[model samples]
Target: MANEYYEFFCPVKMVAGFKALEHIPFELSSHDASRPLIITDRGVRGVGLVDIVTKALEAADMQAIDIFDDVPPDSSMITVATIAALYREKECDSILAIGGGSVIDTAKGVNILVSEGGDDLRAYSGTGVVKSPLNPFFVIPTTAGTGSETTNVSVIKDDKTGAKVPFVSPFLLPDAAILDPRMTLSLPPKITAATGMDALTHAVESFTGLAKNPISDAYATAAMKKIVTHLPEVLKNPSDAAGRLQLAEASTMAGIAFSNSMVGMVHSLGHSVGAKCHVPHGLCMSILMPHVLEFNLSVSSENIGELLLHVAGSDVYASTPVAERPAKAIATIIALKEEMYALCELPRKLSETGSVKETDLEDIARMALDDGSMLLNPIDATFEQALSVLKKAF
Candidate 1:
C-alpha cells in the first residue's frame, strides 16, 4: 500500500536515560553555544538539581551567562518579558531550560523577545508568527509530564485578563531535549500521581480525539499502557528508578503523540479550569479525566475500548456486548481514577479541592470554547455541553 500523506515534525534531538545530564555539554558544544542562559523555577533550585546542571556545564567549560529561577507554577507573560530583557543584557546566545513545563515555557516565551525584539507578548499569540528561530535552546524536563521539552507550543498566562494564551510556532521547538529519570526521582507522591495522570490523559485524548492517525495511535496506545502499569508503582515508591524511567519514557512518548495529533475536551476544560482557579495543571487534568472520557466515549468507543484492553490487558470489547463497550471503557477509566486517588490521596471532585461554584461552570465552558484544543475533539462540544461535563466532573 502507498503511504498516506501526513505531517510529522519534531526537530529536537532527544537525549534520555539515567545520568542524561552528562550529555548536555556535548549537545551545547555541538551547537556552538558557550554562554548559555539557564531558566528554571526556585523549587527546582531548592532541590539542588539546578546546581547539579550548572556544575555539569561548568565542568564542560561552558559558562552560564545568567540563571533565571523565578518562574512560577503557571508562568505569566510579565515573567517572560523580564527574562527576555535579562537575556538581552547578558548577550546570551543560547538558553538551557531546566525544570518542568512552566520553566521551559517561560524560556520559550523569552526566546520570542530575545530573537524577535518584542516588548508585548500579546503581539505573538497565534501559530507560525515568528519569522526566525530563537536562541539555540535545550530543554531538560524534571517532570514526567507536560512534554514541553518536545513541543513547539508554549503556554503563558495573560495577567491582565487571566487568560492562558498559547504561542505556537515551529521555531518554538527546542534544539534538544534531555530527559533524565534522576531529575524526577525526588518528585513528591502528589506530583507523581498528577503528572502521570496528565500523561495518561494526553495518550487517551490523542488516541480518541479527531486527529487520530496511525502513527499517533501507536504512540498513544503504548504510552497509555506504560502509564497504567508504572504510575502506581512510582507513587507507592518515589525512588523506584525503573518505574520512574518507564514513566519518563511514557510521558515523552505521549507528549510526542499529543504534540502531533493534539488533545481534546479534557485539555480544553483542564486549561480553562486551571487558568481561572489557579489550580495545578495536572491536578485539573486528574480531576476532570474520568468525566471527559465518559463524555467522549459515545463517539470514540472503539478506540477507547482498544485503549482499555491495552491498559488492563483484557479484551473488554469481546467480553462486553458491542453496544456496551463504550460504557465499559468509561467504567475502566473511572476505576483507574479511583485507583489513582487511593494511591495519591488526591481529591476526586473539583469542589473537594476548593470553592468552585456552579456559577464558574459557564465561564469555564466559555473559556474552553476559545481554547485551540477544543477544535480537535472527536465530538464537537458546545458551551452548554462543556458546562455539563464540568458539572459532571464537579
Candidate 2:
C-alpha cells in the first residue's frame, strides 16, 4: 500500500547533452544575470575545462567577470571568504561553478557569504538556516561523481578546526545545472570509477533508507540502472563521451533522489571516515557500500531484492530467487567493486585505502553518531555497531 503522505521538491532546471556548456550564458541571461564569477579548482584548469567554459562564455558574449580556481580537494571557509570578497570586489552578479564536488561546494559556500553578506559561515551551519534565496548560481560539473550540481547541500571545512560544516536549504539549490560530456571526457579511469561508485551509493542509500517515496524511488532506480550500464562502459573506454554523459545524468538523478529522500548509514560512515582519515568521500563509500548493504539487509531486504533487477541485469535477476535476491544484489555490488579494482585499482576494503587505520576506527565510529544522515537510517546504528562495520570494512 502506498503511503498517504509524502513530499518532493526539485526546482533546479537542467540542460543536459553533448555541448550543454554552450547554454550557460543563455541560462544566465534568462535569469537576468551577467558578470558571473567562475569558481573551479586547479585540477579542472589542468584539464583545460576552465578554458572551455571561457570559450563558451566568449562565444555567447557574456564572458565571466573573474575566475577563482584555487579550490582544494576539500573546500575551506577561508577559500569561501576569498571567493566572496572577490565576487563583491569585481561586482559579479552571478556564479558559475565548474569542477567536481569540492569546487561546486566552494562556490555554494561563496554564494552564501556573498548573498547573505556574512562574516562567519559556521553561523549558518545547520539545515534550513538559509531563509532567503541565494545568488544566480549555476553549476557545470567536470566530473560525473558528486552530483553537487543538483544537490541542495554544501559541505565546507573549517580550516582551523578541521571540522566539516554542512549547509542545507532549498535556497541552496543551483538555479540551473549543465551536464556537458566534454567536461568529463578527460577524467582518468580511477577517478571515473570512484565517482561512478559514489553515485551508486547515493542511489542505493536513498532507495532503502527511511524516507523513501515514489519520486525519489523513480530517480534512484533510473540512476542505479544507468550506473549498471554506463559506469563499466566509461571504465573500459575512458574517452566514451556518451558513457560519460549517461554517468553524469545518473549522478545528477541520484543527487536529487538522495536530496529529497536523504541517505543513511553508508553516508554517515563515509562522512565520518573522510573527515577523520582524510580519505576521499567516494573512496570511503565505495569501500563501505557492500558492508553497509549487508548490514541494512535485515530491514531493507525486500527493497534491495527488487533493486537487484536493475543492478544485476535480467539473467542474474531472473535466476535469483525472490527470497535470495538481496544477497545476490550484494554480491553484484562486490563484483562491481572487484571489476573497478581490476580496471582502475578502486579499493574494495578500507585497509586498502592507505589512510584508514585500526586506531582511526573508534574515532570514525564515534563521529558517525553525530552525522545527521544517520537519523534516516532504517536500522539504528550504535557506536559498537558502527565500529564493527568499520572493522569488517577494514
Would you estimate the TM-scores of all the predictions? 0.92, 0.95
Residue 282's lDDT within candidate 1 is 83
**Positional deviation of residue 30's Cα in model 2 after best superposition, in angstroms:** 0.8
Candidate 2 Cα deviation (angstroms), residue 154: 1.8
**Model 2 alpha-carbon drift over 4 Å, by segment:** 1-4
Query: In model 2, where is the ten-residue run with the lowest total lDDT?
Result: 1-10
| lDDT (Cα atoms) of all candidates against the true structure | 0.85, 0.90
The digit string of per-residue lDDT tens for model 1 on 1-394 reads 7554556677778798878898988898888878889999999989998888988888888778988999998889999999988988889988999899889888999888888887898899988888687778998888998877778898899999997888999999898888888889999988888898899888988888877788878888899889988998888888898899899889988998999889998999998998778778888888898788788777777877676576776655467776776677667767777887898777778887685677788899999998878898888888889999999888
Off by over 4 Å in 1: 1-5, 118-123, 158-163, 314-324
What is residue 288's positional error in candidate 2, in angstroms?
0.9
Clashes of 1: 0
By summed lDDT, the worst window of 10 consecutive residues in model 1 runs over 308-317
C-alpha lDDT (0 to 100) for residue 381 of candidate 1: 88
lDDT of 1 at 103: 93
Q: For residues 309-372, could you state the per-residue lDDT of candidate 2 as single tens digits?
A: 8798889899988999999999999999999999999988989999988999999999999998
**Candidate 2, residue 237: how far the Cα is off, in Å:** 0.7
